[model samples]
Target chain A: MHTDVVHNEQSMTPHPAGSARHPQAGGRSPRRMTPARRREHLINTALRLYSQQSLEDVSIDDIVTTADVSRALFYRYFTNIRDVHVAALSTVVDELIGRLTLPPDGDFRQQLHHTLAEFVTFVETYATSYTALLRSGSTIATSTTDTLVDRVRDHVVDLFRERLGHSSSSPMLERTLRGWIAVVETTLLSWLQHTDLPREQLETWLTDQLLAMITTTAQHDPTAAEQIRHLLAESGDEP
Target chain B: MHTDVVHNEQSMTPHPAGSARHPQAGGRSPRRMTPARRREHLINTALRLYSQQSLEDVSIDDIVTTADVSRALFYRYFTNIRDVHVAALSTVVDELIGRLTLPPDGDFRQQLHHTLAEFVTFVETYATSYTALLRSGSTIATSTTDTLVDRVRDHVVDLFRERLGHSSSSPMLERTLRGWIAVVETTLLSWLQHTDLPREQLETWLTDQLLAMITTTAQHDPTAAEQIRHLLAESGDEP
Candidate 1:
């Protein structure tokens, strides 16, 4: 039905699994969806609820009702609200990672700008989902398995490792990378609250912040400093 | 009475307000001399509890019972557990701020070393309180007032300003500083999770991470960067 389409594309949050227009956006009759489609439909609906409320505050009924699916349909995919939350978060993280790609050719600063530009736009679009996810404190209830935040963090760590591909591993390097990620994260988190600041400015600041942490870390740990400098030399884009 | 002192000084977290060695460590004769002393006593007790639990998880009855203070006596200083939490957090924040004394005389990096060395030691002693307070997410519940984390953050911001005491204000500067604080905080939070890392190494990494962020920010925001460089020039400790 067009109602489901409109509901799905409600500008609050669109179900990622469904087609952009939902084919049913213009009509009022509900369409029959396969099991996979139903799961995506439920997730997109749950994401909307999550964007509006904290993870603990949303309900299974809220998700089912929003998706226009019956409780029986909802139960087919998820055993509890926690599973839905975890899946919804996974979708967001996947979407975030999928959208990002970094070019290895350019000044490190320029490379940073290219990556952050994409990230900022993403943040602009899903500011609500991003907020709720961080407010979840990088975790989910009822499960100790890796959450979306953990996966995102790993992706970042991997990206940094790839960038510095030749450098030998050390605790200092690990700590520095983790510290830089925290800076980038908190910087973006606070930036979402103050959108008055230009996205261009936020990008530049974040790029610079990461660079600064590296130099600062280098000051105290000579071996790390040397190893990082060597990596930068090999990269052909040393700052 | 001695059992109370033993319980309080169990070393998971001792009162930051008290000397590292509680003069009353040898034997406990619940010394109740004045209202000020009693408030400190209660806060110290609450901190030990909080180290083991979270801010929201602790209760007034838990605190009063632990301190062996009657409910009537507890009522004299605080109206709720929230107030006690805020006050106790302030005490820890004050102790943290007090130990740090950055001389305007050295290289900025060296000064950072001095400041962070003190911070790391403070963190080591009060790891639990530091974790709980930050896990409180830097804002107390049930009120919109400043939390201890806020005060500590402000202190770092102020310290950054004084270090670049002569630089003019810019949004870039502001963001960069906040970014550094986030790095410091998240770095410390994660460090607590992996305590086998030497304290000296942690301090070095944090200091380097902060310095790197400032430099990186300068690279992107040239005006602020130039102003910062000029300030360092004036400080006679340019690297």
Candidate 2:
């Protein structure tokens, strides 16, 4: 039992999934699971693998082997590796979108900070996968994967519009929001790579960047200026 | 010759490379030049083809046909289509980097506006190729292509540092500048796709976005604050 504990120490550690020596070894009972459960298990395994390594390096064989299942069982659920990848990525996207919420009770800046912190958390949880998905020119990137990423951006745009009590977005508002989203992404990507700045500072800096962008846009675009005025009034803050 | 004029009318248009029905026909003579000139002619043809269409669609046959050269001659210079693509992209990068000059005579804002306008012009000139190279998941994207893009970014960072009178960059300044560079890329890619905003507005907006970013960073980073203070003082502008 002591030897088993020593052997499993790597897996027992809560962080640094990359440090696991046998990430795909002996985690599940293959025959006990229903088909749906098995499929979920496979996807979870794939996502776990992706979070620890490059998405291009995670193969069907690795997924099955890690799940302690036969290759036949793996194909029974997903047609191919890319299918599994797409499915796993969709799961991640859904989780990210679902978890992002700007609480109603807080001031706008506080809400924005909390929402961005949530985003940073999600990014941290799936650092490798998020990087692989967003980094251009990855060999494994497909249209399906690209669409999943777009879905997140589109959802965030909608969320912001709804929060601001706007029925629809003007071109200036839309472009400014989308541009800020890109800034968030690029900043997070760089942050993930180097981790030079503290997370709290990065989060606050990102929040401030959006405010700055909106303030800048307001100077040129009357619609943006009016919307920002209303937004600031609602938050009881000065623009 | 008059009939030929009608046939060549598509190519004669001042803009819209995409409108040319035959982008790769009768542009150059085969076997008439020295080997060095012939190789350059082929690369130029490949770039022209890329400018007009998706890089993935431009093939070895297309290059040879456009240059009016034989397959044998094409093989002498390039091992494959991708080789020519890398070469063509390098030329574009070199031209863009070379042409980007922050002239010494203007206020900082004016100089920045002019430099950005030049960049936008380069983007317009190689719109298709630039999109193809930077768009994340083109099947034709290779490590060489990705590296070429990075070279442009790195050069821009160095350019900014030199302009700021900093021999080296602090972490805050580096990240802010790099983040702003990303905003430019993402904004340009979106603009290229939708083109709703006018070129003048886009240029001014991008220039302002960097200013806003620097101001925001100054609040959190002493190094950035000091640098921006110095920068603004030099330009007789407020931060």
Candidate 3:
């Protein structure tokens, strides 16, 4: 008995669910359920419950009851509560990623502002789930979430690459892209951790701050500076 | 027994020490361990044990035998095994924090590079334990970890204010500092997750990337731009 308790405590950390469980028998007539439907049901139910309590406070029983499913059914959909939470949160992250594409014609500043606003809007719309996932670090494993972030990083790098044009080689492009991604991720996470400041204010502030960093760095790197100016000219920005 | 098993599994997710049996008076002589010493012992033992297995795999029997302490003694020090893990992990985080002070007298790029290098060094030194803490979100309380992260953010903010000579009331200072910290944390977490890369290469890449971000961001804002220019001038860089 004692050993069981110890084992349970050790396994409790929320992890990304790698596999979807299939509905099982012995719960309310054993209606057949597909893995996709079961996963969706569990995630929606868990998201609703998590909004009301600490993610840690919600139990398997609460989730099963809320989903109107048996314990076996719950297990069929997710390995644990955290798995459901990740699935629910990934939906919102996916939406944000969809909205953050690079504008075909905008200058770097405009594109950056658009991306920043999209991110803030997503965070605002799903504040509770976003907060829960960020706080728990459970969102780290969701491939969709990672893909969204990576895509944004790639877009930013591409913008810098286009700006650089004929001024740099493969190495410079890699370095610039990597640096931009690191800065953007660090800044976003810090803001998420700190103030619950309203979305518009945060977005504006971040947009301006990011632009400032990009400009200053470019000025110091002669090659990067030439690229920025060329891109600015191409985009018809006032010198 | 069933109820015990449920309770054991639920609690075990956080506390492995719960599995230890309170020794009968004649079963084993209880060691006269101080509270602080016992906690240290438990944390050290758990770290060693946890590193060897998934956080879920280490049992109370594993901890008790390793620590040579009774179950009752373990409970006295921690509410559960998760508490012990958090306490242990907190020590490591605190050590990292202690080493994160910003250096005096350098250009914005140089200062930013130094601070980032410090972070990389800390992460490299505690890579295994750090990765474990990040992976096992189950054992650590979200609120507690957020509070710790907030402290680190404030420290970074203060450094920005001091170095940039910007008042706390300045919105640009707040935005720039907050954004930089966010980028740093996100980059570090991502790097931590990708363990295949060499630490030295990763650190160098991170440092160069962060400096670029800071430099770029500095140029967009008049006040920040001025600060960067002054910093560069002080460092004998020709405008």
Q: Which stretches of candidate 2 lie over 4 Å from their true place?
A: A1-28, A234-239, B1-30, B234-237
Q: Give the candidate number with the greatest DockQ.
A: 2
DockQ of each: 0.32, 0.55, 0.14
Candidate 3 lDDT tens digits, A35-104: 6645655665565565565555678898787655679877766787666656665654555556766677
lDDT of 1 by residue, B186-234 (tens): 7788888887578777776666555555555666767677657964454
What is the descending DockQ order?
2, 1, 3
| lDDT (tens digit, per residue) of candidate 1 on A108-167 | 667667877887776666666666555423334222223556677777666666766544
TM-score of each: 0.73, 0.87, 0.58
Q: What docking class should model 3 receive?
A: incorrect
**Each candidate: chain B TM-score:** 0.75, 0.86, 0.67
Worst 10 residues of 1 chain A by lDDT: A136-145
Error of 2 at B74 (Å): 1.3
Worst 10 residues of 3 chain A by lDDT: A1-10
**Candidate that scores best on TM-score:** 2
State what share of the real interface contacts each candidate retains: 0.54, 0.59, 0.24
